[model samples]
Structure formats: C-alpha cells, structure tokens
Target: MTSPSDPIVLVGLPGAGKTTFLAALWYALNHSTDGGISLNALPEDQAYLNEISRTWRQGEPQPHTATAVFQEIRLCVRYDGADVPGELVLPDLSGECFQQDQWADRHWNQKYDSIARAASGVVLLVHPDAWKGSPRIADVARAEQLIEGSVAESQGEHVASGGAGRAGADESDQVEANVVDFDPLRVPAQVILVDLLQFLIGDPCFHTALRVSVVISAWDLLESRGRTPSVCLEKEMPLLHQFLTSNADRISCQVFGVSAQGGPYEDPRVRQNLLQMDNPIERIQVRDADGNTSDITAPILWQVRDRVVEERECRGIS
Candidate 1:
C-alpha cells in the first residue's frame, strides 16, 4: 500500500501529449471554476507550484516553449478503499530529454535521478512515430555515451569528477549515481505510448512483460482519415497482441483510443494551417492556429481514469 506521500511521475518525450494529458486530467479532477486539487497534499516546492498554477490560469492554448520546467498537481484520490492524497509530477522536459546528450550528463541526470526516486512509479510516454522511423541509431549511441559518462563521473573516475565529498553530494547525488549505474538496454517497468491517431500494432513481442498502455490522441484526425474507433482498434490489436506475446511472457498492455482535441475544430481552416506549419515561428501567424469548440474532456478523462485503474490492477496494486 502506497502512503499518501507517494507520487506518480509522468515521463515522456516532448510532444507526446504529456501536457495535454495532464491538462485534461486536471480539468476532470477539479471540475470546478476555482481550479486545482486540494486534499491531504504532499509537500512540494511552493514557488514552483504557484508558477504552474499561474500558467494554467492564463489559459492560452500555446504549446510549451521549454520542456525542462517541472509541472505538478496533487489530488486527494480514493484508492484501495482509502482516501490517499497523491501527487502527480509532470516534468516539463521534452521527449528529447530522454535522448538528449547534453542533459544525459552528470548535472541533468542528477536532477532527474532525485525526482525519479521520489516517485512511486513512472508513466513513460513514447511517440508511435518512433516505431515507424529507422530505429534512432544516433540517439541510441548518444544515450549509451551519456550513461557511460554519468556512471564514470558518479564513481569519481570520469575526467569531470574532481571535488571529493563536496557539500552538494547528498541524496540527489546518490540518486544520480544509482541511475548512472542503470542498464539502459533493459525494458522500463511501466510505459505508455501516445500517438496522434495510431494504435499499437505490428508486434506484441516489442512490449513483452512490461505494463504498457497505448493512448491514441487526436481522435478527430482519425475521423478526418475516414476511420472509426472500432475499426482502428480491430486493425491494430492483433498485431500488438502478437508482438507482446512473443516478446514477454508476463506482459499486460491495453489499447485506448482518445482524442485530446475531442472533435473537429469549429474552424477547420485554422486546424489546417496549424498542422501544415513547418516552423514554430510561422505558427505564430494569426491566420494559423484555430480554436476548437468540441468537448473532448469527458472521453479523454474516461480513458485516463480507466488506464490508471487498469495499470494499478496489472501491477497488483489495489
């Protein structure tokens, strides 16, 4: 049984819809004009909390400019037949953080190491696009290099390691050392992949033994492509299941088709422009980005809740 102090961490690549998912879940949980979840809250950095609250209140639908800024929310939830106040910490780091060489270094890894240890488990968000592209060889190499470098540095054997037992070396430092020692080749414990509209298909062996959940975002686009939820899932499930069975004997994964946008936007033209824009600066064009009036909140929240419950069951957590 997790204590009220335990928190859930959402880890994903940038653009994997982490923020969107969090926002949707936040709106559902609060369901009030006052905004924000309050119950037996876990302790958090007050200044950081205030910043995120302010940003959400501003209510602009702009994409995040930086992914390194950590955003979190706490809620009083009923779990295991008990009221346990839990926190959800969503790091602002982009999907790139997972493979970025710069942040894989000692300093960046140190920060993430601390956060990772504090959380009960992680919800890793991967992009489906990753499966289509030629496996990211460069990214793999970079990650390996970073891991080696971090390990060496933590052990005071790397070229960068100098000061011995400095005041800065403490829990966070120890955590960093532990993470540095981790073998990246192993599968993550809990992972979720969020695709714009694609479902997990092709192979089940790819996700064997791991608890996996597939989030299909941008449901509106699937309709635009002339597909229904049932049709999409039917086409994808066999492949996903087959792959999982082949890869791991103790795997539990599920497919959930969701639409972060809920439905087609009121102004289709704006959606077109936003989708077609290749440059972020170009996206600022007033003519570009249109707002939608569709209420996707209910459906999106349902999927999230279901997935949370499903994940808990899969992990044998009541």
Candidate 2:
C-alpha cells in the first residue's frame, strides 16, 4: 500500500526548469507560512535547497544540473492546513535523461525506470519558449536508417539514447519493446507518453494510479499573447494535448502555467520586480511577471490533490 511518503517523479526535456522549480517549491513550502504546507528535508539536503533559495534571493540564474546525475532528496510534506501530510522523494534530474527515457525502446530499460514505474505520480515540465515541433519523428527515422544490420544495432540505439540493457539484451525484451504496432517512425510526444503510461500502468492486474502535472515554464512569454495554458498547449503541442485529453480514463492530468524565475535575470528591472515580490503573505507562490500574478505553485497544489492516490486505493495497488 502507498504511504504519505510516496514519491513523485518529474519528467521533461532538457531546459524544462525542473531544477529551478524544485528549488522554488522548496522555498515556498518551507520559508513561507502563509500556507500550511511544509516540505522538510534532512539537514544536508535542506542545505542544498537553501543554496538554491539564496541564488533566487540574489536574482541570479542558478546553475544547471549535470545531465547524468540526480541527488535524491526526500521531502516530508504537510499541506491543506496540515490536513494532508505526506513525503515526496524528489530526484533532481536533467531534462535530457528524462526525454532519453521517453525515447527508449523499452522504458523499463532506462536508468531509474523501475523507480519511475513504481512512483505514485509524475510532473512534466515543458518550456513554453522551446516547445515547438515534435522531434521524436525525426529520431525514429534516423533509427530506421541505422537498423538494416541486426537486432544488436537496434539495441545499441536504445542503450546509446539512455535506455538500459546491453548489446545482448534478452530476446523477450526485444519483443516487448516492439509490441506496439504503431509506426516505427513518427514517434510523437503523444506516442512516447502513451507508451510511458502503458508501461507504468502495467497489466490490469498490476494497474497502479498515476498523476501527470504538465507545467508550462516561463509562462510570462505566453500570457502576453492572451492565451491560457491550455490554449497555448493545444496550439503548440496538439498531439500531446490530444493524448492527455483523449486518455482521461487512463490517467489524471492538469495543466498549469508557472514562472519560477519570473523573468530572466538580465532584465534591467529584475531587481525592482524582486523587491515588489516581497510583502505577499505567501512566499513566491504568486509573482508579478510581465504585468500579472502568476501562480507557480498551482501545479504542485493540483498534483497533491489529484485522484491518482484515490485510484490506487480503488485498484488496490500495493
């Protein structure tokens, strides 16, 4: 059975701002008492968050995470005025590693794939600025050109792209990876996501609940265009949008717009903006970006309240 400490994995492409989001979330949950939420970490892990918070205080851009390593941090949380208290084990992963898992031949082959599969929920971050056309289709075409040799070549591509398994991976693995009869090419975000959900959900007997919170980072750029998060996502990443909307029966999802750093540090008015950010009862939950208040914490709030946990209970998932 799941406990209060069940983990939530954050997935997205590189530069999705997972690192910054985690830091900001830590600060908003811990330092701010306006809300009853609390996210506590061990002293050492707490120090890391503190450093990230300091960088925000200085109005400087924090360093990016190394693509291959993630320092796992467990956060003991209490929210809803302490009505719901749980533990969230967060892995600070670079976006490359995540999309790498998404493109894998067998998702379970990816590093930390098992942990992700067993996690209670997931949060996907997408950078509003960089989210353009689908790149997976081209990646698949390249794979087709490289596949004329043998089974070994296909396995190599999956592994080199960050999936697990070595040169002589099990024959059954090859079959399992190719089970989906969809196009070998045209692996859009929708396909990757569907595969991911199918793998995580497992068979009917192994069905477990999952929550996917898609956060559009740097929302300031889009809000200026008079579009909501859903509106922009539908236009920019329609396949992903349709996938989530059409599969409501399979997974629970919520879309949110967030601006963790508000705007770039290079902006001349950044200092003034930061100064004005203070005095809010909440920490950085709400901030005035271009000219409006953006709720960076809404996704987390929705994630916490999603029905994934309820589904797990109903399905009797261990």
Candidate 3:
C-alpha cells in the first residue's frame, strides 16, 4: 500500500555502501525471476542506473558521493501476487548530509525534513569496518584527570619555581598538544544511528511503527565470525540494540547482513572469483535476520510491506 511519493529513505554514513546497494538493486530488479520483485517498465532516464550498475557489474570500486549531490529514483515496481504495481521513490542523499549537518550540528535541511516526513520506511546501513568505538565513561574520566593533573602541575611549577611562569606555560602547551581535535568522523557509528532514530521518534510528522531495515553492509568481512546481524549489533553496539529493543512498539526494526560486492572488489583474487561466476548478479549476497540467505529485494520488500510471505506463497515454496 505504498504511494508513489512516499519514499523509503536510505540513510548511512560515508562508505556504508548506499550507492553500491542501489546499483546492485537496480540490476537485481531488472533481472528478477517470476516470483521476485521487478520493475513494471524501465524509467524514462536510465542513465543513472546504467552507469552505476555498469560500475558495479565490473567490480569497480564506487566513488565517494560528494556532499552536495543527490540522486532521487522513482520506480514502478511489480511485487509478486499484487494486483496493482506500486511506485517506490528512493532518495539517495549524501552521507555527509547526515554526518555533518544532522548528527554533528543538529541542522536538518528543509528538503530533507520534508522527505523524512513522507518516508514510509528506512534502510539504514552501517559498515562493519567503519565503526568508531562509542564514548565510554572511563575514557571521559581519564581525559578529565589528564586536564586536572596538568592544571595542578602548572600551579605547582608557578608557586614553587617562581621562575617567570615559563615552566607553567610549557606545561600548558604540552597538555594542549596531547588533546585531540573534535572531529565528527570520530563519533561512533552506533551513536549517530541512535541519534538519527531518536530524531525520527521525536518528529511529530513521522509515523510511529515505522519499519526500519538496519543493514550491516560489508558483511563479508565479518561472516567468518559466524555471528548473525542481530548478535553482531547487540555485541558491537549494545546501546543501539537496547534502544531498538525498548522502542519495539514504536519502531519495527530488522537486522540484515548484506555483502553488496560479495567481496572486496579492489582485491584481484576476489574480483577474479566474482567475475568467474556464471552470472555477475550472483555477486550480491543478502542474509536475513535468521541467517538465511535471501534475495537483494527481501529487505526492501520487508521495509515497504510485509511481502516476504507473499513472495514465498507466489513461489509455491513451503
């Protein structure tokens, strides 16, 4: 029951694989089988899809999206067993918009705000390798102690040495040199994700019971650990896990582990292996909450509507 204008927002930090996912998605939908989601017809302008999909299929590394760039895609999709087709508007915003403006400075652009209001679901991605450790009380306390100790040492030098305060000034300089500059990039991915979700919760225009698909992109890097996405979230990002669990009534959240490239595309061996596959589309990998491998559209379908079961029914799968 999704409208043409109600978008499924794609949110993620830089290098979290949004563009790559879009490319893979475009290819998957176009080549989807009888019981899978597919486009009713090609878009009027397939340039964007064509270029990106080409890059993806070639196993080339996707370029980083600039802050000012935006790509909005509208697709008329035919879901299995649905009588009428549905339109899916997916807005691909720069990750910098979320990192610098929203999470860091608390400034939401008017256009983004409007888009968020009309969003029926969200696909938020977090790359496993991009995680910066969350802020810890012990770390904060250690920083405070360092500052306090520096202040005490400076005062002692001034009072005892009485040497024109040069020693105190030098000590102050040392302390300043030791302190690291505050950069938004240093903020933990989970912390920013939690903040984004909290903003959505506080927005009166945004609906409660919003479906969110939290995808752990670059899941291939962690697949050897033998942990599911939910378990990975709980262990790596306990705060976010707890928040989502507590707000389950307001937010319907699912975790997915997706390997859009199947492996590091830049690696010769990996790229060769992917290229050797009979179908290039087989390079995309998606694992649902239960660790079952699924189609790339599975997460998107779940977000837009609970069509996973319907898809199974149409396929006549038990």
Candidate 4:
C-alpha cells in the first residue's frame, strides 16, 4: 500500500521522452533545490537521480530523459487537500525487455511487481515511431504475451474480448491455444501509456491499461509534415479513441496530443542558436470521441497529482 507521499513509477521503452517529461514536469511544478523540493528519502543507490539534479543546478545539463539504466525523481506538492511528496521512478528497461527470455528472472520480475503494488499508478512511455512502421507480427505477439503474463502474475483478469480483432486463420484458436496459464485479477487499477507519436496505427496494447493517454512529443517537428498542432491532433484523436473504446469495456481511455518541446528547435547553422533549450510552456490537448478539445499543460506537479495522488485515493490507500 502507498501513502499519499509514496512515489509513482514511470516505465516504458527507451527514447520515449521519460526523462525529458520528468524534467519538464519538475520545472512546471515550481520545484527547485532551494524551494524545499528534494529526494531526501530515495534509496542510496540512486546516483542517477542525484546526477539529474546536479545537472540542473550546475547549468551544464545533460539529457535527463531516458537512459540505458533506471532513474528516479522526487517532488513535494499539495493536492486534493493533502500535502503530498511524490517520486517518479523510470526503469532502465527498453522495448527490448519485452522480448522473450529477457524478463524471466524472479528477482527482476519481482522488482516491477513490488513497484506497481506500491505505486499509485503508472505512466508507460511508448515511442510513436514504433507504431508507424509495418507492424511486426512478432512484436504484436510479444506484447500480447507480456500483457497476458503480467496481468496473470499480478492477478488481474483480461477484461477485453480476446477474440475481437482476430480476423483471419483461426487467431482465436491460436490465442487460446497459446494462452499462458496466468491470473488477471492481480493487475493494477490504473495504467496510462504515453506515446510520443500517435503512429502505432491500431496497436492492441493501448487497451490493456485501465486508462491510456496518448501524448505526442516534439510537436514542432510535425509542422514540417504540413500539419498544424491542432490539425494533427484533430486527425489522429478520433481513430485512436474509437479503437480503444471499441476494444475494451473496463478500460476508459483518452488521447492527448502533446508537445514537450514547446516549439521548434533552433537552426544548427546559426552561431547564437542554442541547442536543446527547455520549452517554457508544454501543451497537451485532450480529445475524446465527442470532439472535445481541452488544452492542458504537462506540469510535473499536476502529473504527480493525477497519476499518483488520485490513484492512491482510488485504491483506498490515502
């Protein structure tokens, strides 16, 4: 069980903007070394956490987003009439971790199990580019196996129809035959995957989480494709929304087109052009099937509140 002050875990593939989102989230929440925000209670082995803070403090910043190894960030905030201290932990695991035989260790698997149990919720970072390519049948199959296995180990039931998308050649029989013997009741109540690009056309994992939020990072780059932020989101949200809702009943998912980098990057040829400056304002526009667009900022404190604080309440953890 997690207290209101417990940490929230962020798990996803590499280069999925986990570290960048954390940095932006921290800044958005009005946190600083002098302002009573610090990771005083984190484990002693968390050197990466310290390094991230040090980079921001020293004015010589490095990429704090995702690394080959896991990292964590801690923040303190007031939300929903409670004074809360939150931590966001990003596992070092990349998409490759989902491959067969990589996650077979009992110790390794247990770490994620313990974290999920302690965490209020989860944010799964997914790369949009992975979705745009021809769907690797193997990738799809492995993702299904992973979700099925994880849900069973966690004791959660598979709520969506296993056969909804099976269109050809007895896939239902194949899925049933290959179904790993696992229980589903142990799965966590809230899990949201963040996608930097909404390109994984019709991928199935989005429906696995109780609620999914699709976020597009590097919004400025989309302009090169002859699409405005509003126009891009407008085109993508409907397809994603219908797919998720049509597939699952227990799951309630929404799409939010977001840009972590507020605008385009500076040209490299110019002498005064800085490299990778933080966006002063990050925007996320939430779009549902009803065509409602609600513009929200991707603030760290609020994200902690939404993903952690509220999740604790729902789980009756307080």
Model 2 scores worst on lDDT over the 10 consecutive residues at 280-289
Highest TM-score: give the candidate number: 3
Q: For residues 1-318, what per-residue lDDT tens digits would candidate 2 score against the true structure?
A: 544456677776667878778777766775665543465444444777888877766667778877657667777766452344577777777655545644554443354664564576677777864545565556668877776566667667778887645545665667688797665334455455455556566645325446777778776566678776777777777767887788777667777777777666677686467657664222243322233343455565566653445645566763
Q: Candidate 3: how many backbone clashes?
A: 0
Clashing residue pair totals per candidate (backbone < 3 A): 13, 2, 0, 15
Model 4 lDDT tens row, 157-229: 2224453333323545666889776532222111112221121212343332343344555444453575543
Task: Please list the residue runs of candidate 2 whose C-alpha ends up more than 4 Å from where it truly belongs after superposition.
Answer: 40-44, 81-84, 101-111, 133-199, 202-209, 279-295, 306-318
Where does model 1 exceed 4 Å of error? 1-5, 32-60, 65-67, 72-76, 79-81, 101-108, 117-121, 126-210, 223-251, 263-318
lDDT of 4 at 10: 57
Q: Write candidate 3's Cα lDDT for 189-295 as tens digits.
A: 88888899888877787555778898999888888898988999888877788989999888899999999899997689999999898877777778886455637
Best-first order by lDDT: 3, 2, 1, 4
Better of 1 and 2 by TM-score: 2
Deviating ranges (above 4 Å) for candidate 3: 1-5, 132-181, 307-318
Which prediction has the highest lDDT against the true structure?
3
Query: Which parts of model 4 are misplaced by more than 4 Å?
Result: 1-7, 30-47, 50-68, 72-74, 80-95, 98-108, 135-209, 223-243, 247-249, 263-318
**Better candidate number, 1 or 3, judged by TM-score:** 3
Candidate 3: residue 226 lDDT (0-100): 89
For all predictions, the C-alpha RMSD in Å is 16.7, 12.6, 4.7, 14.5
TM per candidate: 0.45, 0.68, 0.82, 0.47
The model with the greater TM-score, 1 or 4, is 4
lDDT of each: 0.41, 0.63, 0.80, 0.41
